[model samples]
Target: MNRLRAVPKQRLLTSALLLAIASPALAQVAEPVSPSEATELDAVMVTGIRGSLTSSMNLKRDAQGVVDGIVAEDIGKFPDTNLAESLQRISGVSIDRSQGEGSKVTVRDVGPDFNLVLLNGRQMPASSIEATNASNSRAFDFANLASESISGVEVFKTSRAATATGGIGATINIKTARPLESEPLANVGMKAVHDSSVDNLPKPMQGGKWTGEMSGIFSTKTDDGRFGIALSGSYQERDFGYNEAAVGGGWYAFPGGEGPLANADPAVNATNPPGPGDIYSIPQNLIYAINGVSRQRTNGQATLQWAPTDTITATLDYTYAENRIQQRRHELSTWFNQAASQTSWTDGPIAAP
Candidate 1:
């Protein structure tokens, strides 16, 4: 399985040394640190990038940050494969995960809604579902952003930055890679991934899942040297299941002269009226709950770009995503009274009719 694990104590110290020397935090671009100052003998290093197959394949034992910015490949070395997952490695960052998966990112224990997410330096859209069960507000669905097309990610963890003044927690800026130098070729590519497990749910529950994605890009320059056109599209699909636990029925009433009796006297009979010996009680109903949840999701997108002049560019893009969930739930209650038949004046076994 493609999974990320927490950094071990030994690896933390070792990887820190390597990362401190190579990470962008100490690099010359965003933050400058000379080799002398980064000469830590013990430090653990982990990559921040997760989706660059080419970059990851070409990584050297000591290679670090790139010239452009902080790529996911730099953070990919740790166990995280998602934005929130990778961000958790950063100090003071927390997450409200779902089913052990990265669902939302929180900084310094602050709620996710307090944070902001940006795509290509612009606000995308917020999810209508609340981050918690309390209010109508919702969390930003970071999963909607395409990680494969991402070139780099910038995080403004501090509140003093002008660009991050919109939100209190932090601001996440996701950037897509543009043409390296105005390539004229018709670039087309596709990728697919599948995941399966025996027991995705609790005991007596088992299932499997698969997901795939395809995307392409086409660009060309007009002969007049003043115009250009580009087109792109992408599609994706996924399937998964869910499970839960519950207990039912807290109280119950028993037979009595009027309603119910507190204690069993065993000394008096029915002629005694609503006194002692009129009631016997224990946990009334022993019930068990069974619930099942399954869902399927699909998303498609198309984009167009045209540049009539060197400094003027116009672009149009549209995306559609749909998800369906099929769920089945049931509950059963069973309680046996070892003596539901026999009856006696003094609470003794009745005659064997």
Candidate 2:
């Protein structure tokens, strides 16, 4: 009976210990760090803030973004230079180029429309949609947005700052020089350029070559008053050339076929080719053509800035562009006879036996 009573006491103690273990509040608690330790962490955060501020200020002072910037003086030194070519130096920038040297700049693999390219902080309106036609592609002409008109260009890579809020891919800002508040003076500039294709293919116009540009800047203060007016304008033209080859192949449907090859065969005449309303073989190498494209563009811009006082300013700007693109293409093909000995080439002589 005494042993049985001891057992009951032991069981009671065990149950109480288990209950305490399962209770969350009774578990061990960790102590918070002391004031000195917390202060040490604050120091690290302050250092990081200072570093970031320094970087931001540097970017602003240089008239650049964290991503990139290009100055007009730099562009003046290169050959066949243009706005798109200048912007290509920035990291992550690419070009949506055609056969011609002319192209639109792309940022970080994004489409040209995704970017917001501004002239003096204002959006430039598009002149056309077809991009290749000068009359149609005039809205974003590189010539109208002259490299000379730009004092500098800034490419914003990220939207970390308030100024970079609207653009997602990137913002290209073209800065223009400010008119002087003091005595004004006139400045004049002229430029000429020539470009020839490296392909060296015989062209109707000898591989497309051309040159043209005119520019002037005038500023003056009233002889007796503080009022001043300034005007600047530029005009340029270029001839672009390109050669392109295109290859295309598509499937052909046959009568009572499960898959595309159910009744497919290389047996057909050119008179009734495989196309809509017909069932026939699809020749892989049916047509081969080389096309030559040439274009001439005339672009110009005018800007006027007025600063009556040190803090008051006004500006007006305009752009005009025209392009004419012409294309000439010839398709050549060879047809082999059933005997394999008779061969005929389009635009070429065939020996008849």
Number of the predicted model whose TM-score against the real structure is largest: 2
Please, what is the whole-model Cα lDDT of each candidate in the order they appear?
0.50, 0.54
Off by over 4 Å in 2: 1-67, 74-80, 127-144, 160-166, 181-212, 219-230, 250-294, 331-353
lDDT of 2 by residue, 1-353 (tens): 99989998999999999988778754446576788776443434322335434543555676533657654432122223467776777789876555644467778887676777777777766543235544533225453455544556778876645463455678877765444432364656676667665244455544345566676656565564445555555666555444544433344443344424344444522232333334433233345555545555554455556656767767776655565656555666654333232222232122111
Estimated TM-score per prediction? 0.48, 0.55
- Deviation in Å, model 1, residue 132 alpha carbon: 14
lDDT of 1 at 334: 70
- Tens digits of per-residue lDDT, candidate 1, 126-167, equal 752213234444456655444444445656665443353565
lDDT of 1 at 158: 53
